[model samples]
Every structure is written in structure tokens, then in C-alpha cells.
Target: MNKLISELRRTALVAGDRVALSGEHEQFTYTGLIVAVDNLAEELSQRGVRRAALIADNSPAWIAVDLACLQAGVALIPIPAFFSAEQLEHTLTSCGADTLISDRRASDAQIASVLAGSTATSAFESQPQFRLWSLAVADQAASLPLGTVKLTYTSGSTGAPKGVCLSADKLFATAAALNTALLATPLQRHLAVLPLATLLENVAGVYAGLLRGAEVILPRVQSLGWAGSSGMEISDLTSCIDHWQPDSAVLLPQILKGLIAIAEQGHWQPPTSLQYLAVGGARVAPEQISQARDLGLPVYEGYGLSECGSVVSLNTPAAERAGSAGKILSHCDVDISDGQVMVKGNVYLGYLGGAELDSNDILATGDIGELDDEGFLWLKGRSKNLLVSSYGRNISPEWPESELLAYAGVGQCLVIGDAEAYCSALIFVTPGYSYEDIGRYIRECNQRLPDYAQIRRWAALPKRLTVADGMLTANGRIKRDVILHTYPELVAHCYPGIVYPIGGSQRAFTPTQTMNSQTDIDT
Candidate 1:
């Protein structure tokens, strides 16, 4: 129980006949994987490169490095492929990482340039040589404990990425907790759709998959058309799902939406082998899950944050609540305090910005949520995103956006902050969709919403916000600041109007008070 490597090594000894890891191009038996890890451990030990960064996409190599790091005690770091160049550079600098492993086929000149300039923390006096290797880059290894494993950075853009210091015990605790929950089902085979850098995936996807004696499938992000398209494109996803046929996978809600669309279009049939599609990152519509299930996709939602070691609350096949992120797991204690989630368990040791869990030990999750009597968690929205109107009522954009997403014409919504003017929204219409068609649809949709919650005025944007542009997470949460800054003109056209109810043949409602002619669209 020292490291995941030990468990994997032991399993490989007995499960040598079983398939341990699979990729778009390569598949390895348990024995083959153990040997690969042993070989890489030997090579890395020689290079004097104990600590390594696996910045590459999901592949056999990624899993190999992960295992190799454990075997050699190199203390590895997995870099999310969705990170921006600035975010990427900051992670490299923060981690004091001396070597990086990347996908050869996917590496662009720009990433190489970024790698060359990447520096280790200046504090480390006996720093090892920093280098970058493509997937094709030959194997090499150097040492153990990678000399007090450096910090792991999150996907947050608020500041220079804060490093989360984890101990061997903390990660081990996470694996044990997750393994106990999964019951180590041997018939399991996990297809990883999320980036391995995600704690949710690394712990629950890779480690859990391995410890369960499941074959972990790592599909190529590029082949899945994750390169140019928003990572959730349906056709590409259909192709990958058909090819890999994993028993389970952790999916973000955005990815679930695409999978739902694929089912709706009858473009593909979800694999008969598929089970346990764990959707998270944002609230998922129950209807979306139900529709997928009707079409034979075993999709459901779960809840976790990076700071909590990922698996805080999950909906399992054994025990599930359709609309709720099911019972909080035994590993952690979740309590609802003033509508916020407070967690205490084997969470992060501390953050780089010097934020420690208060003596109370509850990780103050800014999200507003409630716990049901059955212990299922129902999320309201972020307290920071709450919009209080002139009438003194708090309205969250997520509620309205969630409603709008249930409709067909809507693609993205940014409920605006307008206390003085009125509660307004900046809506991004879907691609090739006309305002007239959307307006007609929203007109019908208005019958379902209350007058105050109705979107008053909204404008169509030319395109969606992208991860590369810093306007989205890999999971596609609307980066509100980026949306407002990038589409200031669009927001200006939508607010402070006397909105009329949809489909009603009414001119408009008379204004009770004079307001700004056009909203400034500033956050």
C-alpha cells in the first residue's frame, strides 16, 4: 500500500495474462506493462531524472510513465493537455520538474518552444537536468522519491497556478478509498475520456481502473478531434466510443451533452459493453441522462473538486439518485453549512499561495448546495455567481442557463449582473442558428419560466468560447470574465429592456424606472 506502483506490480504478477492497458495504437498485457514500467524505471534512474512530467495525451506511454514513476519513486506529475500556454508554462515552473514526456505525433513547434524556456524552481540547489521528450522519444529513467515530489498545479487561472502538495500517504489514502468504493470489480475496463491530469481521472480513472484489474483504454485526443474542435464534438466521440468500447469512463457534463446528441441523431449505438459514464464538473440535466439511458448509454452524474482528491460524491449503479450527485463516499465527510459544501478528509496537504485547511479542516467549497435526507448532494450554483436584482432576490445564471440548455436553440448562456438596470443575460446562439428561429423557440420556452427568470434581451454571438482562448475549462464552464470581455458588444445589445413574455402578442412591458439605455457588459 506504499504507492499505486506496488499494487500494480503485485497485480501484474498474478494478472500477467490479463490486458492491463490499451490505447488507439498500442495494447499491453499486465506482464508487458509491468516490464515496461520496470524498464522505464531503470532508464529514468540512470538519467538522474527522478521527477518527470507526463504532459502528453491519454496513451499507453502516459500510463507507463505513471507506473514507472511509482516503481522508481520519481513522484510524477500529469499535465492536462487542455491547459493554455501561459498556464502550461506556470505549471512547469511551479513544479520544479526537470523532464517532460509528451505525445510525439501531437507535439507542435510552439509546445517545444515553451518547453525549452520552462524552468525549475530556483530554490532547488541540486536541480536535475530539465528536458522534454515526445512519445517517440526513447525511454530513460534516473532516481526515486524524485527528491520530495514537487507540487501539482490545478487548472485554475486566477493566479499563477497554486501548487497542491501531496504526500505519499495522501495519494495512497485516495486510492484505498476509491478502491474500496469500486469493490475492485475485475470485469471492469475503463475508457478514459477526461484528461489524465485531472485528479478525478487519475485517481478514479487510472488508479482505480488498474487496482480493479481493469484494462484502461487511453484514446488519442487528436484522433478524437479534440485538437481543433471543442473536446465534446459528437461525431469524433462516436468514433472513439465505438473503437474503444470501455466498460466505464468519467465524462464531463459537456461531453455527456455531445454523447446525448450522438444518440439523438442515431449516428451511433453506444457500445453494449459500456457502463458507468460518470459525468461531473457542472450540473447535468436528468433528462439528458435518461435519454442516453433510453438509447442504451449507462450515463450518470458525479461530483468532486480537485482539492478534495476528486471522488467526494458519486452516483453508482448500486445506489443512485437520478437528479442528485449520489451519496457522499465514506472516505470524506460532507456537511452543508449555509448552503455551501464543507469537506474534510484526505484532501490536499496545502496550496502554493499559502492557503491551508482551517483548523476545522473543512474545505470551504464556494458552491451553494444542499444535502438530501438520503445524503445525495444537489448543487445550486456558485455563491460568487449569484445575481441579486433591484428587488433584492438572488438569481444564479446556472439555473437559467441550465433551463436554457434544456431547450434546443440555446448553446451557451451568461446570465448578466444587473442590479441597477435589471437582471439580464448574454446568450450565445448555436452555430448556423438564426436569431429569428431561436427567438421563436424561446418564445415558446417562456411559457415554462416565471416572468422574473425570463431572459429579457439577448444577442447571438458568432462563435463559442474555447479552452485555448482561455474562455472555457476543459469541461466547458463559461469563463464569465472572458465572455464579458470578448463579447462586450453582444451584452450591450441585450440588457435594460422592458421584456415581454414569450409568444404573447404584446408590444412590451412599460418600464417602472428609467435605466441605462445600454448595459456596459463589464463584470
Candidate 2:
């Protein structure tokens, strides 16, 4: 595998040359990017800054520091822009970061001092001691690392962050997987629709775009209807695509749905040069793919996690699977044991703060899946997240939730009866929708489901799902545990008493009994 820095150096030799990256941000030629990285690398080394945390909005420099890490061999931790101040404090301190990087707009001294103090072990809940630097100033002293590349955290440690260590070579290897999958040669152009911080998008979206020598487009967040500073906006995305016209890109399921919506509204046109649309991060409804296809979009499903440097499986332009998260990429060595997906190759070194990963460094992904006769993999559900009823039956909630989405005005629904007395759900309906109408809609939806699989009762959440509320991920999947934790009252209404398992002496129902929709409504 080519080390990340070496690849950049090789690509930059021609200078003023090189193509778009991952078909998103129209970054500088290899020569320009190399020079910038080299300069940044020198600046960091001169200051003797071995490790730094990158906290900033979307910008070309964000990725520069990322690549500079590869060159300097210093590990980089990227905090998502959407992370709250509290979340940020925990992540930075937990990672023991020494230097902090941010944009011009975020040059608050108090915030900087607080962040710097987090690195000190003694700081604990208090901020550590460190130096904060703004993007405007160029460090006179920078050096490139010949070692580890980057460290990313994903909700693993509960309170503190867990780091996934990816070497420059592995990061580059992940990018290489896409070159073949995307048919991305020197001529293609890709766009970065998702955040650059995510390992999945960072590796596949940006690095893959570069491997093909393609132009990468990254539009402003505001243009995309991202009301907050964190996620991408639809308006910005459509505008970027219409203006630059990229060939390939990566997106989450919801973004694909949004594109389909825009096309249905006749507001955007599918690019003539466009080829692959990689979708992943959460379970994408099969119908969502069909709907996008009806609008002339070629959206391919994918599956991955931060530990795998983002991509584990992708449906390449060559071997396409409609519903399955394409075949495992060349970079990942995947196997299914006992209905669970286990992967090892290119796995992260360990979590942050010196805690070791599971035995054998193999990530036994909790996600349940199966490989078909043709070898295409389809996801079923999460093992840990599976809901078990008081009646001793385990239920895969996603199976039922996907069915609910097909109903009009049914925005989001969470099946929450795991280890509980009876099955119930917490639903977030489409804006301005009435709970009365939703009840009718769910009743109809339930009629189509088996008795065991049907939701017995439901409660409407007062608020819409949002990242701010921790109810949704960046891709818009319900944060199951977070939702339940925030709305215990709603949860309790469905399962009134402590869930008790049915005894062995339980008897069968009488022949005179008739079916009922929910126990709430007396039959």
C-alpha cells in the first residue's frame, strides 16, 4: 500500500496537474495541495507540536491538516462542527490533545484556554492546558511525520471519545478501494456532499477522488438548507453540482432522498457526466433507491464504520446490487460468523486514552447481516440494538420501521419494547401532522404486519428529530438509546409496569379470543 504522503508527493510531481478529488471539492492540483501540505507540515514540526485537534467549519485547510498529519506522521483528531461545547470539551480532553486548530471566526480566548487545559491529565472535567491557533496565521515551522496518519472517535467510550487509529498506508488503501469501485480514472470529477471529517467520507470521498486525479467539489453548508452550522444543505449541494457538474460522489440515505425530492420537483437535473452515487452510514430504505432511480439517479448503497476507516462494502459501478450494501471492497477482509459481520484488515490500532480494542483487533460489527448466494450482503439489524419483548421474543425493529416509512406523514418511528412487557413505538410525524391521523396511518400499517412484529402502542414525541437534541445522527437515523433516555415518560406510557417475562406455565389463548390492534384500545 502506498503511504498517504507518498501518494500526494507522487501526484504532485507534475505540478499544476492532477484532477478533481472524490468528485466534490475542486481542490488545487496535486502540486498546489502538496505545497500547502508541505508548508503546513513544516509549520507544525517547527513548533514541536506532535499532536493536534482540528476543530473548524468546512474549509480546504481542514483537509490540509488531515493530509499534513500523514506527512508529519502525527495523529489527527477531527471534532465534528456539530458537536456541542460540552461534547467538544469531553472529546478533546479525552484525546489528550496538545495543540488546537480552528478558523478565524472561532478565535475566542476563553474557549481556547478552556480547550488547551483539557490536555493536562490533571484537568479532568476542567479544561486542559494548550495553545490555540487560528487558520489565518501560517506557522513558520512545520514538519511531516513518517508515522501514523489520523485518529477519529465515534460514540464508543460512552462519555469520553474512542479513537480509531488509521495509518497513512491504510487511509490510502481505503482510497484505493474506491478507484476501482468508482471507475474513477484520471478523468472523473467527484463531489464531497458529506462532512469531510467522517472517516468514511474523508477516506472514500476526498482521498478516492484524489486517487482518480478528479476534481472535488465542496459547497458551503448554508446553501444546502443546513440551518445549523453542522450538516450539509440541499440548496448548496444542488447549486454546487449544477455549477461544477461532478461525475461521482458519496452521500447518506437521507441526502439521496432529498436529491430525489428535488428532481421530482423539477428543481435539479442529474448530471450527464455523473456515474456513481454511493450511499451509506445508516439503513437506506430499499424503496428510497427505487424512488431515486425513477427520477434518473443512480444511487448505490454502501456500509461502513469509523473503525474500518469508513468503507467496508460499496456497490461499485461495475458490480451493482440494488438493495445490498455492495460487495466488500478489496481493502476489507470480511466474514460472517453466527449472523454477525466481522472484519479485521485495516482495522484501527486501538481506541484513544490507551484502552485496547477487542481481541484479535478484529471488529465484530454488532450489525447483523447475511451474504446471499451471489455474495451480495444484506443487513438485517443490530444485535445490541435488537428489541426483545417480555414474551421472550426478539424483534428486529428496523424491519417494522422501514414499513412505517412508506406511509404518508410518517417521518420517524422508533420501536422501543426491548426487554419490556409489551411492544410500543415512539414516532415523530411529519411537520403539522396530527397525532389522530398518525394513529389511523399506523393502524393501517399494523394491519399489514404480523401480530408479533406489530407495534402494540405508540406515543408521539413533542419535538422533531435533530442532531442538536441527540435524537438523530448526521445521516438522520434515530439515535435509539438517546431518544429513549430523553423521553422516559413516553417510554413508560407504553410499558407501564416493570417488564416481566412470561412464565413457563403460561397458557395459550382461547378460541373465543379475537385480534386487537393495540392493547390500549379495549377489544
Best by TM-score: 1
lDDT for each candidate structure: 0.64, 0.63
Tens digits of per-residue lDDT for model 2, 71-149 = 7756687765544454566665555566766552233632454444233222101112222442221233222223446
What global local distance difference test value does model 1 have?
A: 0.64
Q: Report how far off residue 54 is in candidate 1 (Å).
A: 2.5
Candidate 1's displacement at residue 304, Å, is 0.3
Model 2 worst lDDT run, 10 consecutive residues: 121-130
lDDT of 1 by residue, 86-158 (tens): 5566665555566765553224642565545444332111112223442221223212222234256554423
